[model samples]
Target: MSSSARPARRRLQRAALPISAVMLLSLASAGCGASVGGAPPCLPPEHTVSPSSAKPGDSVTVSAPDAKCDPRYGEDAVISIVFIDAAGVEVLNTTAPMADAGGFNFTAEVPLNSAPGVMAVNAMPHGVDWCDDTGKNNRVSQGELPLERASCVLPTKPLNITK
Candidate 1:
């Protein structure tokens, strides 16, 4: 092969990457409720945690107003919210089925065993544990979803668990 052809081949290979990625994204967004072609279509909801603070064991209302979903996900598709305490442990996982407007609202309890501090909560597709053992200490359980950015974490204000 000519040197010029080598460069062209390299360019073609590079070009194929984005094409492959797009194809993969398309198939993944098709949402069979699982990852396909190295992409996971986990569209996080536009949600709010009412009160922004709660006592341990207390419940707060979580609502998502314009929850977006790709064409693959049906109107009745489900979204799961994961609550991780300061210790990087998942306290609760709530699966909420979307409504006609593609949104969900529910009440979740802050772990009564959780210490008084900030907690992180995020929503993603059901079955994909996007935010599990958060501190990256490698204690995470199975089914952790790997995403290429675009994390769908909610809660504008820090959810402080009161003492």
Candidate 2:
């Protein structure tokens, strides 16, 4: 109300403003430290397969590390297999939900009519925004296998009885 009191009030307000801001910032940083910086709290899950080589009838076994990252970070983990021919054209693309056990085993019957030479297995956590600390939606690490080219398998060949 008085000139002297006005100055004191302004000073107090200024000091309080900064302190409030610092507290808010600290809370925000703690909640989102992982998305902000430093090595990811946890490296993406690791994946592996048994009998790296397999024919159409043979079952393919796959495994991956647990999805330890918080789901709030965005996107779920995806396991996929890419089949490519000698010409480098993708012939088949297969993907399945990652199991809670961090492992997956599914039998993929080779298409009797499919043309194949080599196949590649890949696994990645899709729809995550590792770069955006603000938590905006984005592809943080999609289609990136923890270890790309983890395994290769050949498909079953058709019988040439006529020959």
Candidate 3:
């Protein structure tokens, strides 16, 4: 409580305040780094495609699990459909960005004019190397589904079209 000692006490308190704040900030930022302390490991998103095989003009639905984990890398998973010919040539390729929901569902009409031949349908985590081969790639989860053949003729029954 002496006047001479008061300045020393104030200086010590000020120094301690900055040190304490820095410690707290360091701890807080440490948690923000990739794979935070004791946090659940983030696995890549999983995907599935309903009716893995389909004909031209058929509706194909692709579903993917949410990609937003504790450490979110990005939003909007991209879903794509690639049509290939019998000789293993890519005919048409289409890609669409879908929001990351608990599961993302995408329905697209396979182009009626798409070349008729064996094709592959793949649903994978956007921007990831889902499969080993490019053209043979299937759903990352499904490993590799056999190549699907699109018939030149439409279905026998009258096809019902609905959005």
Order the candidates by lDDT, highest first: 1, 3, 2
The residue ranges of model 3 lying beyond 4 angstroms of the native Cα positions read 1-41, 67-73, 100-103, 113-118, 125-163
Tens-digit lDDT string for candidate 3 (54-82): 67778867666665664343475565545
Task: Write the number of the candidate with greater TM-score, choosing between 1 and 3.
Answer: 1
Least accurate stretch of 10 residues (summed lDDT) in model 2? 154-163
Per-model TM-score versus the true fold: 0.52, 0.41, 0.40
**48 in model 2: Cα distance from truth in Å?**
1.6
Looking at candidate 3, what is the lDDT of residue 122? 38
- State in Å the error of residue 50, model 3: 1.9
**lDDT by residue (tens digit), candidate 1, 25-89:** 43333222222244554344456678788898788877776534432445666777777666656
Candidate 2 differs from the real structure by a C-alpha RMSD in angstroms, to one decimal, of 20.9
Poorly placed runs, candidate 2 (over 4 Å):
1-41, 67-77, 99-106, 113-117, 129-163
- In the order shown, the candidates' Cα RMSDs to the true structure are 13.7, 20.9, 25.2
Model 3 global lDDT (CA atoms, 0 to 1): 0.44
User: Which pairs of residues have clashing backbones in candidate 3?
Assistant: none
